[model samples]
Target: MVKDLKGVLAALDAQEPGSLLGLRETQWVDAKSGPYQLADHKAVEELTKDVAAFANGGGGVIVIGIATRPDHDEEVLAHIVGVDPAAVNVDQIRKLIRQRITPAPRGVRIGWSGADGERVLFIDVPAQAVDTLFVVPAPVGKPGSPRTDTVAVPMRDGDSTYWLPRSEIQQLLSAGVRALGMPTAQALIELVRHAVSEAGPGDGPRVGQGLPDREREMRVAYEQLAEAGLGQPAGEAWAQGSAALQDLHHERDGEPGWVLCLVVGCPPVVVAVPVWQAIVEAGRHAPGQSPLAAIGLPRPPAGTDTPWVIAADSRSVDVDGGSWGAGRMTCSGRGVWRWQPLPRFSLHQGRSAEIGTSGQTPALRLRAVVNLPWAEAGRLEISKPRRTLLEQQLPHSAVAGAVTMLSMRRGADLPAARWERGPFGNSARSVGYSCTIAGSHGGPALKASVRLALPTTMESTVVACADVLIEDAETWAAALGPGWETQLGFDEVQAVLLAAWETAAELLPDVVGDVAGLSWAAPPTTELRMTCEQPADNGVLPVLDEFVDLAPLGSNDGGPRSRMAVTIIAAPAMGRAERKSLLREALVRMAREFGYVDAEVDVV
Candidate 1:
């Protein structure tokens, strides 16, 4: 479960001092009953003992990076910073433990953990029925002590605690055998033989005569039990229990060999339990990691970067007469600015944009004559073009105040026209046109018109114009029919249109506001005279047979729009009943938006 070094460090930091219950320092143990020291030829034997002891004692942590020093303060120093580089072959460690330890510990998780890039192995030993004891050949110390005279056994009592001495160990082993149904000597012999066969040709000894044979049997049994899903193998379980027992024995005797041991049995078990218990504990613990715990949260991967544009300035114009006229108002100041795109367009309305700015800047207003088809919508006839100049340095707050005031005064009335600053730092402007009309449908037909207000000093400029048409609910329903129930509705249609607009904005480099100089041209002016005649094929319809005279504005020379006349005819399909039905539905919606009620639609 400890996935990385972060987890290991967190685990260590969370532990209470001296709470490493079932671990023992190999080098610190007394010679008689201890496993091999770090410098000894039988060092593997020491590792095997602690591993088994921890397993037998009810599971514990073993950290190999730090060692206890014999200083006056009884200080613990991080000595062997990590596993020796020469010992990179973990197979050797595995072999030593597998060959020397009894009922070899099951589910033993081992790996490196340290900032120094040194190896620090960990063994998670599970508790068993009785204590597991480790037997190692005793080393004779100087003078009177004879080298290799007798075997010494070391056992773990509690975390960092160990116990030794033949008599006490024999007593513990006897008790364990008695409690767990003692195996006969013949059973041991048979087990050793089985181990030899299973270990294959390179393995040594077929009897109790070799450590490999005994270890082989223990490992086999442990594997079998683990495979059966019975709380690890008996070997590890017994080792854990034995470790705890050894700790208790060491505490009473004050023996030197049994210095590293751990005790756990009461409530609030030490160490993070397995997944099942952890789940239960999680419910009991408060949200977030405790000061003593380490935790991690998952996060989504990073996404791709997206490009965006912001509007800087804006202006609006309203023409008041049917003739050509020009008016300007000085507006200037400074302010923070942000931009947003325009909303909903039916003509593949590409990206729309809006900008907000605040500062001591100048604001300009223009008046213009707008053409409409309905006689009820009268054209403005101005007596004279009037220009008003207002000079005032407005604060940043005034801009926001102006926006609020404008919004309030509108009172749900959709804006008829608005302006925006150019994309670049240029004296460019933009205009928006909107109109609303009553329809037979539940909602009103909303239409948007647009024009780019560019500086007209430059000629031959290409400007990209975008327009959006918002269809009424009735129009959409009529167009989509019942399929609207299964497909995306009006809202989805709007979203798709907005997406297309954004795509177009990205694709088209020469956007209207992007460049400067030339202004967007309006429809050219013209004077016309014409003659009409009845169509021979369709008696009810009339067509323009010829033009009497035509003239273009700005020049007397004949232009593309001058002296043009053409006849029109309805297609046979358009005269069909089904086609007429579709046409009526479409025309009804279009006519409603154009403010034409009960008006005849003549197609020629």
Candidate 2:
């Protein structure tokens, strides 16, 4: 709970060290064991990164000189070890914060935490506008070039910050969702436009030249003292007008870009875990050459439970394909893929073709979808009462009947989205939708696709309603599995709540303590309806009142139970290793409950 200066001080006063032990680093606050080394470029980059992440993630605090220890899956505050103030240079740190972060997150504060001269330094960042993403220097780019050294956009996820996957940047810019999430080419063009006027006659290209004209006509030498960001124009490589394309073609969703990328420092996003596993399991069609291995990712020994996350940058070297091959020739970006999670298991030639050029690696960025099923929120029509009911628990940002808030469409053709009415290709009795951002982090956002299966019987409602809620929980759990912890004002545990009541329920006080960062004295009120459908006027509208069961939502009330009557959308939360050792214990405990013998749960 040591997320603020008050908490830090309390810990210092009560215990010399470890008073705040075992406290996880929340989204709004993080602790560093020592002062930043200004002389090291990497250290300076990291310093700017920490500041940017806080600002990007709705602002928070970074406490330096606070020692921490890894406890379970999280790093907890372990000591009050202080840094020598004499060895710290507050002014330089402040300068880097300003110089490195684009637009320098508004209202940031830097100073000692307590007293006139305290042992710890606090870098406080205010929530930045999401309208524009912040950018920093990427490790690889055109060498010795100023302003053209390939800048990366850093985004904060939970308590950790990652380079905004290049694929996402394209989607945001294409959707015109934010200001700075531009395509690499457009980003470069924008940068050029922003700085060209200030350059001297011979310093760089003129404003009058078109991009192609500039690329074909200029040549300049590297400036050893050049800086990559603000106050500098495009570098010598760009000036020489070499044919390095901007490569940022903004697209909706994500693109299965031209080249196969290998992600560094992060795992590929799982668009649909089940679908992913199907493809992985399908690898048995041919042994000794797994799909993951074809992409250069390392797999654990056959029987070990270890996960094979692609966490390293293996994109720089030459790869020999087992079932695939190398074919580095084209640069037109045609075969280029932008968002295909499952690229055709084939050879990659794009990297070999660029060896002597950009020197940049195309890191793999995997992704997954987050739509929950709704019979058809966009197309279906309903009375005022039913619409209001849908609006309550599955609340959204738009006005009462907006499709974004409650998409009432037919069961089959969902989220493929035809915002306008006038389609008759297909239909289904059930439908489901998706999401990426955390719901509580920001609302009025695209949260989930609620599946409202058409036909409903007394028994099936339980499965339908529970399925959506279960997806809501599991999706969040998947989002924060390993290397994920709490974030201030964000309660990840709410996703895991199991409710028995139909109308509404208050989370038990004991459950409140399991929340992420901030604690609540009084639990919040949340409606937990086991059913979304209302019975006939003559029929008693079934409610799970203090106890008995029944369920689900939308126009249809009760019909004969068909496969169409129920739908289950689950987000795989744990890894394959989760099946180890806990199955018997779970089966033993779960079997005690009536009609629950085959319940399958993937737990760590």
Candidate 3:
């Protein structure tokens, strides 16, 4: 089972010693006589049926050109009647199988080998979570033999093929659903258990609070199934099998930071596997072209570009987080192909999302996770009046890092999840984003939380803040003299803030709004007035606005700490809490700048 190329080589080696006649026939293994020519329509149909059975059932290998040894009395062994390489057409056979199969199997392998002076074709069909019965249309006779092809559902019974009974078809479908659900449930249980075990002594009671109800149901179902001695190993197998997961484990297995996890349920809303896979693989390296361009998410226009601030500079956003680079690829198809990011969402305590179409859709569930280094990401935050400086830089930079991650290939929708203030409001220490990024074409999707918490590696929030301050000083020349002019234009600054505010509002619709109003007076002695354009329910501003005035200390003053006055304005009748929220929002927006703003807003 573990054998891939190694297994093939081992088979070839074993053939040298003696005939492979006595090879054991397991549920996952099958053998077929050599179909001399793929032009033999009947033979091709039979092969398609055999492969489909293996996929619908547990995964198995079909060794073609193998037949029972005539001289041997035992039924255990078979002789390799190697295929004629020249006569056998692999492409034609593959195309036939792909066209006939309802939903193509994932990870199917086709290979050829010569053993004992004979060539053989081997097809490795991987088990699929979607229970789709593969049907070959009729005309049991030759092509165009006065008979049209009739759809016939075939199932493998031991060493034979039979029409799957209607009752069994229902049962098989149910099994397929269980196959997908049970493993997911089990994996989640394992995740919660892992979280509990890893939590510090003081963090005892909150281990699984973030688990979603759907996940909880899955956990219960998985437990029940396990008790019945019927469970799925798919989730665990997928996690182990993914190259992306392996890389993440290697790079940041135990480090604490924000994690974006994707659970892509197949048949995607878009059934373009070839295109999807291309982009996913291409995204791992410097793609031949901008992968996002294929998916219609081109880089922003000039002057409107919201650059990823993670880069040391404000110039370009080039981050490659995905580990596996693309290999050679050549595609031939009818339509134009485009790339799309994998579906993904945030996963943390108290947040989760579920998305997909109804029960009618067939899907193979896949899960992937991306871990963002807290130390590096946290370095984007700022303290005092410069927090906006960091927030402003985070989106594009974080996106570049996140997009390139191999795990992101599993992320389905763009902007799957966006950040929102947490229960205690925004903090340099922690924040959470939520969204759903998984599903088959019209299938339901799942949601999860992406939390940016203080890194275990960092001593305190202050330490993370200091890291950014120091970096900002060097990067943006935050230590410039009093007479130095700010290089940021008012429009550019407004655009950046508006962009972030919009993102926040999108992620936290109930709490935040669009830029109702934005007006900034020039830099030195700058007067900035920001407030919600539309008033809340009672004709009063939902949140109050504030004006901050800062006077620089003399050049000889120690580190920069200017004289500051924070003027709090009450929206005619807005409450203290609303005023506070408004102030926090203002602070959150303004903290991204290294310069100062000093002015008060008096409502008209």
Candidate 4:
């Protein structure tokens, strides 16, 4: 949470004396005399060991812009500069600590020193609950003790000094291995359960009977509970209400000994009695045959008396019925039954009924048929109502009917479309027929094929309907042209241009000029340079004669449309009006080529 150099300096200034000691009783003297020195790997490792030791014993602080006096000698200040604040690499240092330490400590604060603009790393290692020990790959030796390199270091008691001990050093290296065999709360419970289960029945203390050692028995019981999925060592609380009741089992009829019993609930007398009776009867129906046996409730022998009894004093009425004897009533005595006389009738005696009327005969026998071509496409048709209704009301467009028929004919020879006709005044009232076409490359072709019989009256309604097909082929082609060309390649661009030219020639003759066969070849590299045709020279010349600098519009790499503007010198032969007109035409053509509809052109 500490912020800039000012805050860190303030915090350091507020700390108690002797707290700013460096790795080995190192103290921060005046920055002007000797600034903090950046410790090398050996120094850092030693510092970290002292830090861990300090944390394990009690919390301590390490100040970077500080030096310590050795051998009870006060420092004659030496100016050893600290690490450059701008290049401390604090994250790398933190990562090193995490990788080196076992059960890495967190919450260490690092900051910069304000006085000398140097790196100040503060490691606040809190007091660990358990003893914290670190294994150093190499040792920091005594002042003159041959420097044999100690493998591990411990924070010596009372002093902020780090000492490499000969005996306890091995213990640090083996700490991680020793941690593996230590019993976790859950593991301990499992061990106790295993011990209890191994004890023979009636051989050890009876179930719930106090063991010779109460603590040992409780430990065993706790272990058993854990084995039954009730133990949570990492501090998850057990469920209290109905779960507690369900978990508890006590002895009822067996020799004052406990056996696990799974109790569901205590229901009302009436509900319990009937269920109990049904269970008994079901068991009696098939001796020793009951499904509840899986949950430890098996059917007793047929002649065995039911041990479970519905308590007489228990509530017996059905809660849902609102009456004590409501469940006992029969359907015949209830209000649901009724009687009525049947009308004497037979299909032979009945006259032929018209679908929409009570008539003896109808003109047409109609049947409704529905066909779904694709899983998502379907059409419903009422054959009987063909003459009754002119057109079927569809959920989507009237075109849906046509779409349905076309899909039906996909990948198959076109079937004769079905239709119905109603009589008109002189001719019959004609209901138009339609079918949907589906599949690639079939819509327009089918539409063209069907449009032939538009005015002709055909006996087959289906054939007449086919003639009315309308295809949006040109629209679809125009929309897909550019995309198809882009997918195909630049060669296709010319093809697309030709196609567009032809389409425009047909659709907008006013804008397109008389056709001269289109031809194109890639322009030369010299042509890529910006040039303007000079009427006086009878040739093209670079637009800018002088050194002209260009910058991107809006300081971007390119303008809004990747466009740039250039001004050309007025030619001697061409009038200003002629030059302006030529520029306008060129700009318009370029805009069209670039697919811009609202490009602006200016003459300067």
Question: Candidate 3 — worst ten consecutive residues by lDDT sum?
Answer: 462-471
Q: Write the per-residue lDDT of candidate 3 for residues 1-604, one digit (tens) a residue.
A: 2234234334532233123456645466666676635556776667767777777676667777777543333233366677777766765665556545544444455656554357677776755555344555543667543222355566666545576776886676567557656675675576567645533343222211233323343343334323222212111111212111100011222321111122222110111223333433333212222222222211222353221111111222211123212122223343332222221111121111111112311111111111221112222442423334334434443222332231233232333333333322456544443333333332223222223333334321111100000111122122232343323222322333233222222222111112122110100011122322223357653221111112221122222322111212111112435433444444333332323333222210
- lDDT of each structure? 0.29, 0.35, 0.34, 0.29
Stretches of model 2 off by over 4 angstroms after superposition: 1-22, 114-118, 140-148, 177-604
TM-score of 1: 0.28
lDDT-wise, the better of 2 and 4 is 2
TM-score of each: 0.28, 0.30, 0.31, 0.23
Cα misplacement distance, residue 473 of candidate 1 (Å) = 14
lDDT for model 1, please: 0.29
lDDT of 4 at 588: 38
What number of backbone clashes does candidate 4 have, counting pairs of residues 3 or more apart or in separate chains? Answer: 24
Q: After superposition, how far is residue 9 of candidate 4 from its true place, in Å?
A: 9.6
Q: What is candidate 4's lDDT per residue for 50-85, written digit by digit as tens?
A: 555654555555555454454455342233345465
